[model samples]
Target: MTHAHAARPPRVAAGPAAREPAPGALPAWLAVLWAAALVATLAFAAVGGVHHAAVGVVTGAAFMALGAGMVVLLAPSDRVFVTRLFVGGFLARYVAALFITGAVMIAGLPGLEGGKDYLHWEASGWAVAEAWRSGSPTVHLTDKDPGYYYLVGAVFALTGRVAVAPLLLNGLFGAGAAVVAFFLALQVYDRRRAAVAGYLAAFLPTLLVWSGMVYKDVVLSFFVVACASAAIAISRQVSARSVCALGASLVPLFMIRPDTGVTIVGSAALLVGLTGRRRGSKLAALAVAGGVLLLFLAVLQGAGLGGKMDLLARFPNPLTSVAVARESWANEVGAGSSGLTRYLYGRNLLLAPHLLLAAMVLPFVLPLPGTTGGMMSIGTFLMPGQILWLLLLPGLLAGMAGAVRERAAAGIFLAGLVLAMALGVALAGYFSNPRYLVQGVPLMLVLSAAGIGYLRQRLLLYVSMLLCSVVVFCLYALARGS
Candidate 1:
């Protein structure tokens, strides 16, 4: 029943073997310069009250320097440099993404209000601390989940209250998500394409904006990517170390947001049930894990611990009171067509079908305005925008089609997509925000890369370069404004 005795498939050609180190690799001194530039840019933003223009100049200079260092490090001939660059690039991207998002949130975008919900969370965390100081055995501050708040509170406690911590943390999560996405893509595609996708996901504008905020979406994104990466590793019959890594990734899901945790656990159980050679044993192990998780949750709730456990309660009834509360909040926030009352009652009913369609299509077509400085305003409905966006749909379809011809990639794609969709639908209430679609970003990138790979001789190169240019421009605009 084990993989050791499982049916073996025909072996494909192994990937490239290790090459000898080249002497002319990027010098250590150059790497140090790149790191110093990045560190200085971040430190200046953290302390100095610089203008947006100045901050942008510093940020761009640092990133550009880092990118150049990466190019030198990745040079194929310099195997040692290539290895160093690959590792350094990954770490640099993670830190840079976090710093940039934190800086932007600290800078505060024009017209976009700042420091409302975040302040509230911090206050709630303070309340938790006050309760602890008293003789209270349990601390129930507010309805909001305290996991993120506690983490932020610890940072605030150490640094004497900074407004940028939440955003910075979110950015860090975004960067982590990007790194995970890159490795996941590499598993399905080649190393170069995977690296590109990872970098794009990290630096993408919409992602950057979210990273700078105090929200659970970015946190959810990190776990989602971790889950996907774990699944990919498992499918490849990778090392036991990889399996342990997958299990460890799932731990955060349980604590960050229980509903997501349940969905992930359920999906993993389902996959194991459907595919595991020792189905009974696998199911038993899953049941034990699920039971233990539920018991822990029950203890937390019974102890009157902080925050609402609505995430657990909503599982049996997906259309629960929480959904109703969210709908009410959305109406209050004027999310739909007209006034709150109208949108809540008659307008929502009228627009339900169209909204559903938009929900399905927007993720694919949206050019991620965070990347393009032009606000994702009504202008996105224009013909040029429509044409540009349509390419993603066909690109994704073509990649899936191509995967059908390549069984290994197909399995990875199907597993990842199904898990993604389940998580997406489970978190459907937040679909209005493009950042919720971050998990799918890698899949889209893979498809786009596949399309380019498939049509390398035709207009593919030109088209890919054009898209890349647009994306880079958008990122530059975002960074400049920050």
Candidate 2:
């Protein structure tokens, strides 16, 4: 509704820039995503049994109803494509979640015992839910990501006592994230790019796979994106409504991922403070943004949360992280493919700041998976998503230049987001966990969408650099005997 900071062509139109896309705009790639999930589900059914999958589908459908119901009630009347994208996003995650747990368990994939963090969250939430239902105190569960377990527990209190309930909710949240992403992209980019971003946000293999499983990251990601969307709105208009929306979305996030919550708050404040058209109005908006930031920090600190803010000003400092300089280096390095379990294994900071370099090259990665003997001996259920990441790589690089540019207010906020996430990853060394990348996926997709057209121009150059990065990194690993 606000065009104050909107980017546009020289030519103008009276209608909304993000008009309805062509018929069948949701596209067949979404179908391919579902098909991949289906195959994985089938694999689980054949290997494990149908019982787990049946429960998953039933449970997923229930969660889908709740999440989708809210969307339908609140969604703008004119955006049919948003609704379609929502369905595609929800179904992809729901179907993927249906049997993914069993598939991981039986196949002995990476993080097999706990299916990474999903089973941990599910089991813990189930216990917490039972404890709450029985009116007992002291539901002993993980302190890490306590928000996820409690939320999952709350859902179980109202639904069937299904173990797969969290997965279903994950599917729903994943869809919510896509919808949020659609609006975020529309902030500065055109309608067509927004649509591409919407679908990519929904069906990108990493996003769908992570959300399909029961874990904190996907849930946290939805809230993070929601906060960012609200922040962008605030940056453009500084409305009472937008500020409240940001707060509503941000409170739950302190426990989900404190670093991200704090970063967005600070970033939003910076944007509001900097982008005022009139000094008088800008001062008022800055006061509001600043007031919220100070109040939130005080409240969150008092609640024994936001400890991540203490780490905020330290190494991999968000203030200087991923400036255009590093982005240019990333454009040259092209080395996000390898999970940085031991990047710079034996090297010192003089040669390369491993995590910092890893941080700059954003897409996402996984620890090279095999039998623990060699990288060649591979047998994991995550192949599809990793393969998908490879395919998305070029678009990611192509989009790099856009973020680093001096862009609109909405665009600057987005660039700040990616920079903050890169810093978060560097400091946390959450190298092996793809979940850590959840908050950045929409930006990556939006960037990818924006860059897709220009990719052919440097197709050969990027591919060769990527191959070189891989080969050189592998040789380094061999030399170190890792």
Best by TM-score: 2
Clashes of 2: 0
Model 2 alpha-carbon drift over 4 Å, by segment:
1-55, 105-118, 139-145, 159-161, 278-352, 371-379, 456-481
lDDT of 2 by residue, 1-482 (tens): 35853655466565434353466564565667667667766775676568756666566667666766777776765356777778778888766665565555555445452344555676777778888877887335656546777888887776646655677787888888888888777776777777778888888777766765666778877888888888778767778988898999988898777667766777767766676544357575765578467544533332223245553333343334333333433333324333343343322223146544556543445434552224221214455666666666666665666555645666656765776676555444443344577777777777677766556577786687567545544543343233
Question: TM-scores for all candidates?
Answer: 0.58, 0.74
Q: Which residue pairs show collisions in model 1?
A: 371-474
Which stretch of 10 consecutive residues in model 2 shows the poorest summed lDDT? Answer: 371-380
List, residue by residue over 1-482, the lDDT tens digit for candidate 1.
Answer: 57865777756665333332345666564467467546745665665434432444443444445544544543445335333433443344334444544444555444223345545665765555555556553336654345665655554454334444444455445555665666666667787666656655654545544455556666677776677667556644547876887788777666666554555555554444444454468565775467456534433332223224554544444335434634543553244334433444444454344344334444544333342333432222122433443454445545556666665543444444533443343234443334455545544555556655565565665466457645643442342234
RMSD value for candidate 1: 11.5
